[model samples]
Target: MERYVDGFVIPVLNEQLDAYREMASEAGKLWIKHGALEYFEGVGDDMEPDMDGMPMVTFPQLADTESDETVVFSFIVFESRDHRDEVNAKVMEDPTMDSDNYEEEMPFDPERMAYGGFRSIVSYE
Candidate 1:
């Protein structure tokens, strides 16, 4: 069966990477508790790759990151689009998400974060 996934790309200050990881770890737990199939948060260790002269925009370029910042790529998977919606709804309603420091604690600028939902077109495993 095909799956649904919510993906995100964010530019985080190098010094705030730890804080971002902490927040994302907690969020991942909440997502899993709310029925998400999988959660992953990866920091960009390699923002650019050699493409044999092919033109392509790198993660840093897409995120418009600076020398003091790096990119974070994350994704949460669900059984299907409907399942994703259900899980996200539950996650939003989760009391743990209502922290008073919600906005202040976020390590990256929300306006610069890119988010999207995708339907899997192929699965090999």
Candidate 2:
């Protein structure tokens, strides 16, 4: 079966990881509650990989992160593109997603965040 996913790459400050985690936890729950098949958010643990010769753009470089910032890679999965749209619409209407409820500003820079929707071309299990 083909799946739809919304991916995000965000640059977050080291100190704000806790806050980001808190927000992501709530958001993940909401996504699941709204019909997302799966939700994941992971912080950068290993930024520089030993390619043994091959060079490629890293997450830090892609996010343009500073020394004090780490990348937060997140994705939400759905059965299909229409399912994603339905779940997202419901999630947006949830009170917990409201920006007014937050005490502080967003943990990451919105302009630097990369977002995309994808359809799975392959799968295992």
Candidate 3:
């Protein structure tokens, strides 16, 4: 099966770092339970634009991040695109995935988040 991943970059207020971690941990567990092969989230330690003369698109810039905000990069892996669709359907149906409650509970602003789905082109054991 072709592997797929849904990646997200969220700008979180520095003071809410711990809250964001807790929220993400809960979401990750829920996603794994719904059939995600893997769920990973990481805080930014180095988020500078490339110096190699590239297009200069950094995570901070993509997230429209501010000085008081930090970047969070996350991904949920799936066995395949179809599997992703299936898992997401079940996840959304889960009671804990409620959007009304999510807004109040989430630690970051949804407007400043970046998200995308990708099919892995390469993999190594």
- The whole-model lDDT of each prediction reads 0.93, 0.92, 0.89
Please identify which of the two predictions, 1 or 3, would achieve the higher lDDT against the true structure. Answer: 1
Checking candidate 1 for backbone clashes, the offending pairs are none
- C-alpha TM-score for every candidate: 0.95, 0.95, 0.87
Pairs in clash, predicted candidate 2: none
Runs of candidate 3 exceeding 4 Å displacement? 49-55, 99-103
- Expressed as tens digits, the lDDT of each residue in 27-125 for candidate 1 is 999999999999999999867788899999999999999999999999999999999999999988888878764766588898999999999998776
- RMSD in order of candidates: 1.3, 1.0, 2.2
Q: Which digits, one per residue and each the tens of the lDDT, describe model 2 over residues 8-123?
A: 99999999999899889988988999999999999999899999989899999999999999999999999999999999999999998777888888877889899999999997
Residue 76 CA error for candidate 2 (Å)?
A: 0.7
By summed lDDT, the worst window of 10 consecutive residues in model 2 runs over 99-108
